[model samples]
Target: MTTIELTAEEMAFAGKIGFYRDYENKQRSNIADYDTKRFNLTSLQAHRLGVMCEVAVGKFLGLDMLKQPPEVWTGFVVSEHYEFNKGPDILNRFEVRRANVRTSPIPLRKKDLEYSAQVVQVYVPYTQTADGISVPTQCELLGWSDSVEDWPKAETPSWSKNGQARVVHNKRPMSDLEVMV
Candidate 1:
C-alpha cells in the first residue's frame, strides 16, 4: 500500500482553510438549519479532517494541493424547495470517506449517495511527537468503489440521543473496494 504524508506546510495550510470554513458555517447557519454532521464531532473537527483527507486524496490523484484551494463539500440542501446536489470531494468526480488501517465498512448516510462518481476511502493515521502532541503524518488511500448501489442498507452504528436509529444507505465493506493505484 502506498502511504501519503502531508508536509508541515500542507498541514498549516489545511488547518487555516478548515478553520475559516467551519467559522463560516457557524456564522451562516440559522436556527432553522439542522446540522447533518454525524459522529459526535464539533463542526470544527469535521472540517479539519474533511479538508485534510480531500487534500491527501487530491495528492494521490496527482494534483498539487498547495497550488489549488480545497473545494468545500456542500452537503444536503437545507431549504425545502431545493433538491440535493452531487457533492463531489475532489475534482467534481469523487467522494472521499475517512477510514482506518484496521478496515471497516464505509457508511454513507442515506442523503449522501448523491455523489456523482466513485466513493474513495482514505485513512489518516496519527503519530505522537517527542513532546507528546499527536499529529497526522501518515495517510493511505485504501480504495474506491462505484458499486455502492449494490451495498446493503443498514442503520447507523450509533443511535440518536432519543435512541432512534438513523439509516445508512450503503454500508459497504472495506475489503470489497477496488484497490487504487
Candidate 2:
C-alpha cells in the first residue's frame, strides 16, 4: 500500500477588473452590448472569482469527477492598492496577493502501487471584463515522483498467465455551478 499527497498553487497578474453578471435567457443575445459598470471588488468577491475559475477549469478537464465539492479550494488576499492606467482611459488592475492550493486528495488502490508523489499547481488570472468578472486563463500543475527507500516492496501482480477477476466501479461528482443558478 502507498500513500500520496498532492498540492497546488494559482496566481493571476496584470489582469483587468470589472463588474459582470450572468445574462438571463431573454437577454442573452443582448449581453455583449449591455452596460457593465466597474466597481471595487470586496475581498470575498475577488476570492470567489478565483475559486470559480478553478472550478470551471477543473470541470472542463474531467477533474471534477475526481474530487468532492469545494473540489478545488482557494484562499486569497487582495493587494492594498489598485493599479489604474490613465493614458487612454481609466483601467482598474488589482492583484490577488497569494492564492495557492491547500490540499488535493488522490484516491487509488493501495496494492500495485510502488510509490507516490505530491502534485502542486498554480493558476494565474489572465482576463477580466468590464462587468467586474475575472477568470484565470492560465494554470500550471507540477507532479513530483520519488522512490520510498524504507518501505518494503510488494510483489508485482502477474496477470499474464493466470485468469483473474477484476471489478471496477466509477463515480462522478455532481457539478456545483450547474445548480448555482
Candidate 3:
C-alpha cells in the first residue's frame, strides 16, 4: 500500500477549497436535485474528501493536480460531459474513491464510472472527527480498478452509515498502478 502524506497547509487548503466550492454551489443553486453518492457525509465533507483524495492521488503518482482549484459548474446541470475534474486524469484517466482500509470496496456508481477510465481507492489512516469531517495527513493508496465498468457489483453492506452500496470489487493492487503509465 503506497501512502501519500499531506502537509498541514495542504490539508487546510483542501478544507478551505471544499467549503468554498460547496458554498458557491449552494449560492448558485447548483446543488443537485438527485445525489446518488454512497456515503452519508454532508456535501461539505464529501467535497473536502474528494479534493483531498485527488490531490493525494496525484502525489502518489508523482503528478500534479491543477494549480488552481476548479471553477464551479457554470450551470446547474452537471451532466456526464460537463462534470468537473474527477481525479489526476493520467492519459488513461482516474477517479479517486474513499473507502475503509479494512473493508470497503471501491465506490463506483454507474454515472460516475462513465467519465472515469479507472477507479483509485483511497483510505484515510486517522479516525474521522465527530463533526463528520476527516482530512487526512496520510492517505493509503489502496489500489485501483481499470475496466471497472464491467466489474461485478451488488448492493453490499459496509461500515458507512448509509449501509449497502453498489460497488466494484477486485481492483488491481497499487503495485499494478505504478507501472500503468
Task: Give me the candidate number with maximum lDDT.
Answer: 3
> Each candidate: RMSD to true structure?
6.6, 20.4, 5.9
* lDDT, candidates in the order shown: 0.56, 0.26, 0.59
Candidate number that wins on lDDT, 2 or 3 = 3
- Which segments of candidate 2 are over 4 A away from where they belong? 1-41, 53-61, 65-119, 127-133, 136-138, 142-181
lDDT of 2 by residue, 1-181 (tens): 1111222332221121212222112234422211223224444354344344443344333443124222122112212221221110111111111123313221222221232311112233434568655544444322211112111332223321232211111212222112220
Q: Give the worst 10-residue stretch by lDDT in candidate 3.
A: 72-81
TM-scores for every candidate against the unseen true structure: 0.61, 0.23, 0.65
Clashing residue pairs in candidate 1 are none
Q: Look at candidate 2 and tell me the lDDT of residue 56.
A: 38
lDDT of 1 by residue, 110-175 (tens): 334544356666766654356533547566766665624533444445533332223334444445
Q: TM-score: which is higher, 2 or 3?
A: 3
For model 3, what is the alpha-carbon lDDT of residue 72? Answer: 21
lDDT of 3 at 74: 17
For model 2, state the Cα shift of residue 104 in Å.
Answer: 19
